[model samples]
Target: MDVSKIHGFNFPCPIRFGAGASKELTDYLKANKLSRPLLVTDGTVAELSFFKEIKNDLQQKGFSVEVFSEMHKNPIKSDVLKGGDAFHETGRDCIIGIGGGVALDVARAIVLRVNHKRDLFDYDDLIGGDKYVTEDVPHFVTIPTTAGTGSEVGRSAIISEDESKKKRILFSPKLMARMVFADPLLTMELPPFITAATGMDALTHNMEAYLAKNFHPMCDGIALEGIALIANSLETATHRPDVESRAKMLLASLMGAVAFQKGLGVVHSLAHPLSSLLDTHHGLANAVNLPYGMQFNYEGFEARFDKMADAFGLSKNNGNRVVDHLFEMNDRLGLPTKLSAIGVEAKHIEELSELAEADFCHPNNPKPVTRADFKNLYEKAL
Candidate 1:
């Protein structure tokens, strides 16, 4: 793999991927005749040197840029609304997402909110809101700075109700980015903990997608390969960063996002509650709950677990070994091995279980997950 060069892919979306892919950003915008762009990102990324450089490049090329960086780690409806207001007030013609998941999600939601102005949550794809997404969205592009969430290539935004903190999905094919610059060089400066948490998030996406009860064999194959890539590179990316490791992780993360179009399962259901109820980082929540969720899913589906074990290069037919690897991976990545370490108390279990039971991801689990099962998993992980 020539990690030094750029490559283009048209699967799931149009992506310019590799070490220097971000250099093409201005050219793409020029070709589309978009002179003014609203740059949406999180606060931390907005301060980073690489992000500043990207912003600088656009300005040097004489493009008018308006930046909106006020957003939470878990984005809410107001974030999208605020960004939409920025676009309208600044007279921007396009939107460019330039951070991790939170930034990308808000940007996509802003794209949806810009032209189709009903109540923001009224466009929630959960309640048949996508049918109302008939208007043309502003040209949107993304340049991912993290290998987690893979929202750079995704067509949906997971925004929450600010007061209730209940997640709502704002989805549409029109929400897809016109182009993605997936430059691994942008991820090279990630702190170790961020790398570990995001890498584990990628792993969880692949694992749950593969085990989802959906019948898409193409997604199944892509999920297994995504599992293999993360298995080979995640620890290295987290502990000792390099372009090769970051490249593999970025590719695997994108693959996970694409594959999970088949569906996700119990792990996401377990993770979402932690993010909403406890305000934990989404990646870290997924990391902590991953092994426990896999353990719960392993019993009735030993053969499926064996397939994942094969991806991890474990000895054949031993489903428990697959679960063991997940636990071991968390430890090596310097992530917490239990819920208690992340501030989840016994008092929080019932509410968390309720949230998990109501989450949208678990119905696709190969085995049905009851509220009782969620409660037990929380207890065991705690």
Candidate 2:
């Protein structure tokens, strides 16, 4: 389909999408007059051929690129501080985030830290902390290697506090990537399990956004379409890894992120603590807990669940049908049906619930969630 030739677009920021779109990165950097950019990625993605190729290409073009792969799976405040130190030490002028949520979040957090005087948590979104983010960040670009989190398109970054193990959302318009290079080919080599988990994360984002009691019709429409695309293409993208399926999943991931600017719900609220405490993969945590979260909210939002059921191609058009479809899909994807299977235990439920109840995403839930509700949902998922 000559995916690279597809037009670049801007919803809020420029997006160059399709296969091999990442190859334009060097030109994009030059056009913006950004010669010294720090490349933030994980150790694993740093070792990939695409990373090496991109670094080599930029180096050959005489760009001063320094790679920082010290990001953790669940990015911590300390990690961002270290990243800030690296950015200053290298004297880099721009930031290029080049992986999934962790790397991207760390990159954005580093940008926030680069010129700010206050602590990282001072910019937490919960306490109207975004106001403190007054300074301009370095020019930023995002190249996503996974079709989840949509951190590339997002304006907020989730970084955990080291002592509390609580996830903090750092948000600002300045945190948005100036450009996103979304190339499906980058995700072609993802293992099937990761494909399945991250695909479900995308689904959760769409569903939660649609269900949230928000007034943004624009986001609602985008969320519904994103759900349908993920429902139709996720299994194939996981199993076969074709260009079309990969591209659809990538688009769906971006749509999910864009839509969730309206807000997320109980699923993310519950998933955050699992990642913070158990160190579970964020997408996998979301996948394991999504159905239980859906069940918790189903009675209150029957019509919303029915719409999602229709998106999943269920003729019944009911909340129960939607939940059933999720279970079936999870089984097919070989995702753990219970949290216990993924190292979450009964003893940890209370602590996890407390953390979930305090999460920023918790208050945005359509059905009000309490500490007891959080505990019950955890028990149900377990």
Q: For model 1, which pairs clash?
A: none
Q: What is the Cα-based lDDT of residue 203 in candidate 2?
A: 93
Q: How much does each candidate deviate from the true structure in C-alpha RMSD?
A: 0.8, 1.3
> 152, model 1: CA deviation in Å?
0.9
Tens-place lDDT per residue, model 1, 1-382, is 7889899989888999999999999999999999999999999999999989999999999999989999988998888889999999999999999989999999999999999989998888889999999999999999999898899989999999999999999999999998999999999999999999998999999999999999999999999999999998999999899999999999999999999999999999999999999999999999999999998888778988888898998867867798788889999999998999999999999999999999999999999999999999999999
Candidate 2 C-alpha error for residue 377, in Å: 1.5
TM-scores, all models, native as reference: 0.99, 0.97
C-alpha lDDT of residue 48 in model 2: 95
Which residue segments of model 2 deviate by more than 4 Å? 1-4
Candidate 2: clashing pairs of residues: none
Question: Model 2, poorest ten-residue lDDT window?
Answer: 1-10
Error of 2 at 174 (Å): 0.8
